[model samples]
Target chain A: MRADGVLGMLDRWGRSALPGATLLFFVLLTLAPLRAPYLSGALPLLPALVVFQFSLATPERLPGPLLLIMGILLDLLLGGPGAPVGVSALGFVLIRAAVVNNRRYLVGVPFLFQWFGFCLLALGFVALVWFFTALWTWTAIDPLPALMQYAVVIVIYPLLAPLLARVRARDPLNVPDASRGTARPGETTS
Target chain B: MAIRDDFEVVASQVRTAVQRFALGLLVIAAFGAMLLGKADTVLVEHARVLALDLASPVLEAIARPVAAANRVIADLKEFASLREENARLREENVRLLAWQTAARRLENENERMRGLANFREGPEASFITARIVGDSVSAYVRGALLNVGRKAGVASGQAVVTGEGLAGRIAEVGENRARVLFVTDVNSRLPVVIERTRERAILAGDNSPQLRLTLLQSVAGVQRGDRIVTSGHGGSFPVGIPVGEVVETGEGSVRVRPFADFSRLEFVRVVDYGVTGLVGSGGPAAPAAPPAGVRVR
Candidate 1:
């Protein structure tokens, strides 16, 4: 086989794993030591941000299964009294749902508009997490953390938006393929 | 070619419909997961342990370079202050040595008195040194991840500390990693005693740098700058471990600045005082909350 063909095979597999890998990166960052006491009020919602970035930019690359899996992964990693299980995953899906539908309009707007859009989506994300936690624990989840997390997400979105823009532009997974043409359970004749 | 274009359009519509359906199902699944988590804690606990076990190695890998970089920075700062620090340390050492002798005599007298009274120990403690791999210094939760875990017999409720003072207790222990709930976590409720007055209070964390001394027997007579130490009320922590000093003493609000610098934490000692059954029965619950009477911060 030609070297290009072998390389192409490797590229395809990498592309297949890219969405999962990207979501995982956000999960890993959640554990980084940022010991600033003031900053502790709101942990950065990196997974939600990543999901929003991708779903807006490349919906086909990020399918529902991967989104759900990444959310579950985040919940499992961060589960305890600190955060309710499945909250982050649900937050990610919520962000994806919001972003994917309005992506076309968001794609052409100025960077600031996009940033604001993300901030809005991130607020909903935090709210989703807060809602789930409140429901499960039978206590009103403290709104301070959720509020702080949203503030941080908004403050840092501009700095991160460019990176997300670059990823959307260059993501191999975003390439049109069978992923976009995926059929439902059974619809051979249309 | 026309047929192919028509097929593409049909496929796109089908894909969109399927994707929306999948999203709906995922929302349900996420809700289901939370419901299951609330209904069945055992499964969540297992998953938490497994996730932490898997995360430990990755956290270690992530911390290596960052730790090295931090050391480089620390070395530079130490070098910058070497002469002044050395002189200060020498004077402090002389003072500490004199106090050490006095402490030994006091310890002897206390042991003799306790022996006469037939006092039983709370829980014998042993410590394991570990690295701070990751920490979430966020608005809601103050958690520190340690590189050492179950392999080192590190368990939840073990007091994590530094040379400076008491940091927090282990909240969750994985196979090779443990998350330390800083004394400043909103959920942290420590049973502490004022060293000078012997007044007992619950040093609770409200997600701040300083812990609030809640459930105080009397806000009165608690002087400013008073030393606070673990009372070992529940036996999870060893008694007399320096927790913090009174930093604020308003009538309604009192706070203690924790001895440990949680923000700059790197390495720590996870001391399991063997309160095994007293509190934290191999679970994430911290020592019982102080009986209700004091106002929360």
Candidate 2:
């Protein structure tokens, strides 16, 4: 009985850690040297997508600290010589804050509505990073690349959303609205 | 049951408060890190190098299959253009053969003059070929992470190049990985000379595809198609390494397009010319003496 209990505890812990692990995988994926010009530029958006999806779907699984760590890892990996560290971390934190603040409006919304919300959030995120980077570098950086990044993120969101939803559904502890300690009209604890 | 419900509500409220507090702290911490990094602190560089060393192996492992797939795609592309490419190469080879003869004649004359002047030769450059395992994800930064480092004798300030021309210079070196700050990075600055006019200038990257030629003494002599090569002023890079060519000569802002394609870099040779007067923050370790019988020009 004790062994079974320990196994169950381990399984629960693993399930809880899945979202963070997925984020980490996306972080590494972003850093992979794809060598294709457009794909290389578009890869950085993967982690942001994961952060947004998890923040809205399961904020508790991906807490602030995990996002902080993921952001730092990205900054370190992507921060070249004289590039400011923690800018990515800052971006990730702001993304989570924006999503969590509007979670009530976004959680049960239609997919198109959620995607529209993401477009605004992503634009804001890109602009924030661009502004902070320009301030840090003290130069008028070109805005075209940032805009391109935003476009790619917006285009990719709807396609990646269903995949993220599937991953969330497979989580053993993800009991719809039950673990959130609140149930909507349509969602009920099994 | 009423007491339990009240306790649960209080606990949830406390949790929410804690999360908000933690988020605020993380934002502040990130700002602190950015400031610390901008200050160019050694602590931050060391931490970055440590992170790079830890992550390089996994990145390298992941890059292999992608590289293979890329190669296959490249092969298909090449096959499609094989006829035109072959015709162009054949024409180019014939032209190069004539240039090769002239180059050989000039080499003989230069050698004779050097012997007559008893010119001292600099140490021959050694190369360490490294595979590019990763690249900067942020558009703000222009750099690449190479899969060679201190273990492979890749020190900071070595000139990284491709067969075409100078790509960039080594910025940070770790135990098993190193970062190359591309010539198009905002932080990169190199002294170069216009080949046609011999006018010197500072080649600066503004995080754009084309590098800006700043600090030029004579912009009047600059024109389109002027070749820019390193002047070897800072002792960080060797003399006469091809950097780029003047593509645009706008008013007060000249743009030079780099010869080495930063987007498609796969393998780069890190050249150690034994000159170690790197000019930047956290400069390379104390300059090693030129080996016996070898003198820096």
Candidate 3:
């Protein structure tokens, strides 16, 4: 029974290994140099996609602790003026938990709820985290531009979300095993 | 049976708590690493250097093809609008032709009288041209990397200029890549002289397009349309390089309209101001030019 809890968490996330590939894609893309000579205020949010993936499929896998670590790693790796990753990651955790825990009301709902929720969560995470951390770093006054740039991330979300959903559907881990006595509730198969 | 269930629940709670504590420590550790690297740490510097080195090749590989594709798309779009573009170009050409005539006359006159003036007294500067291959990926940073670096005979403190005027100076140097801290960065400061009055002031940027001239004791002496030039106070930049023109703002602070077009910087010159003076290996005396006895009548 004890093994089941740990194994259940693994089984849930292990289903869509696509998040791992997506994370790598984003990190490399972010680390990769731009092909132009002008600055781009827009940044592709690979981490936010990770949040959405786990939120929709395996909420238990993306625990509070992992989100926090991912956030810190982001801050360190990106090395922005402020430590924004921490709060953003926390936002992801809270948003995911709220949506998953309240999945009953949202059941049988169309994709719009998921899309809108993810955008708000991602934007709010970027804004709140960037706003506060920037304040700490004495550069907090520039929130307007940050918000505008985050809107770009939101605009690109709907397009990216469905593709991720398709990838998640094809994962073998998402396949239901009826023989595992009393399949856990709310685990969607198909 | 009840006691056994209680024990299991307590054990799981402890495990969760332990995991949380470890994560907390990791967060603190990351913060510590940032603070430790506040000023000149090898690890942070090494990582930055490695990132630049790694990204440059990627940038170089993609830059040409992307630019070419953009050009092709632009050409296709312009084909539908060529008639309008042609009219604009013709008008621009007429204006440029008039300016070209005046420019040619000035150049001839200046060259004829150049031998008699201070032209022979100043140290000559030479530069290597480089292309801007990549832009700052991080939003807070106001700089870009060029393919030229220390290994390419580039050095720190070398001033980079576009065709219009001074762009910025090389801040960091890796093997094949160097970062240029633009004049619009908060930390950037340049000693500039107003060409009209020869009044010296420090031009500083706060990551804004409008750069302020600091330490202006008498605002009355400075006026709009005054040309700014490098004062050569810090020796980082060459004297008389065109900086920008002054514009008076309503806030009572003077802003400079940068001569270089930051929006469309493509090719730049890396002024390799010879480091002979810095390294104590002063080169041989400047090559003597036969005295130009020509005097302007």
Candidate 4:
């Protein structure tokens, strides 16, 4: 009985850690140096997609502090040659806050609707980065790269979203499907 | 039931308030990081280096397979163009043969002149080769992370080059990794002279494919296809290293196409030319001498 209980505890721990681990995986994937032309510019969008999907599907799993840590980790791993240390962290925090607050409207929605919402979020995210980078460097950077990245991210959303949804579905500890009009597992309906 | 409900409501209120406070604090911390990074303080540099060192292993492991796949794809592309490439090479070989003969004659004359003038050769440069583990190529930044660092005698301010020409210089160094600031980065600036006219100018990168030739003393003398080479005016780079070729000359603007291909770089050589004092102050007390059995040419 004790062994079974220990195993169950471990299983719960692993399940609970899944979302954060997936986020970190996406962060590493984004930072991986794939030499394809213009692919590096578009790769940073992968983590942004993961963050958005998680916030919408399971906001409690990915809390504000966890998002902040992942974002800062990304900024650090990108090294000094890219944007300053906190730029990505800032972007991630704002993205989670935005998506979680709007989760009610976003959940249970048609895939296309979620995608449209993501498009807006992505634009705002990219613009925030571009603006912060410009202000940090004190120069009018070329907007073409930012625009190209945004376009690529938008194009790639449909392909990556379903994969993220699959991960969310696999989580045994996941809250009740919000689209089904049920309250989340821990919430009091009153 | 009523007492339990009241306690639950209080707990929920506390949780929400705590979450909001944490979010606000994180937002403030992010802004603080940006400021610290902008200040470019020692603490920030240390953090950046530490982050790079920690990530290098993972980056290298991931890069290997991607590099292999890239090679296979490149080979496939090259195989497709084999016949056309062979034909082009044959034509170029014939043209180059004639130039080779002329160059041989010039070399002989130059040797005699140098002998007569008693020209002394400069110190031979030593270099360490490093494979690129990470490429942070974005619209705003063009930089790379190398797998070699201080342990291998790599240091900041050393000129990095690929087979073609000058790529960039070392910007930061850790125990086992270093960051390269590419020549096409917006922060890159080099003093160069036109090879044809020997006119001096400053080569500046604006985060674009083509670099701009600024501070030209004789703009009228520059034309299409003029080669640009390092002037070594700033003591950061050695003199006479090939930089780029003029691609366009317009009203008050001239563009030079860099010889180094930034997108396709895999390995680079960090050359110690024995010149220092331009970039960061930290380096080996003695110049990095080439290890034994390594050629120093």
Error of 4 at A85 (Å): 1.8
Question: Which candidate achieves the best DockQ against the true structure?
Answer: 2
Off by over 4 Å in 4: A1-6, A80-82, A176-190, B276-297
Q: Write down the TM-score for model 2.
A: 0.89
In model 2, which regions exceed 4 Å deviation?
Answer: A1-10, A172-190, B1-8, B276-297
Tell me which of candidates 1 and 2 scores higher on lDDT: 2
Off by over 4 Å in 1: A1-4, A34-43, A134-148, A171-190, B1-15, B72-98, B104-124, B275-297
User: What's model 4's lDDT at A35?
Assistant: 65
Give me the TM-scores of chain B across the candidates: 0.80, 0.87, 0.78, 0.89
Ranking by DockQ: 2, 4, 1, 3
Candidate 4 Cα lDDT to native: 0.80
Task: Identify the runs in model 3 with alpha carbons over 4 angstroms from their true place.
Answer: A1-18, A31-39, A44-110, A127-141, A174-190, B1-15, B39-43, B61-65, B68-114, B117-122, B218-227, B243-248, B276-278, B284-297
Quality class of the docking in candidate 4, CAPRI style? medium
* Sort by TM-score, top down from the best: 4, 2, 1, 3
lDDT of 3 by residue, A1-190 (tens): 2326877778655554445546544544443344332224455355666676556665544565565555544443454333333444455555565666555443335777766676666766666656645654565344555566577667767777677667666544443233234545434443
Task: Give candidate 3's TM-score.
Answer: 0.73
Candidate 1, residues A17-65, lDDT tens digits: the string is: 6766887877876776644333433445876777777776566667777
TM-score of the A-chain for all models: 0.79, 0.85, 0.69, 0.84
Q: Which window of ten consecutive residues has the lowest lDDT sum in model 4 chain A?
A: A181-190
Task: Provide the DockQ value for model 1.
Answer: 0.42
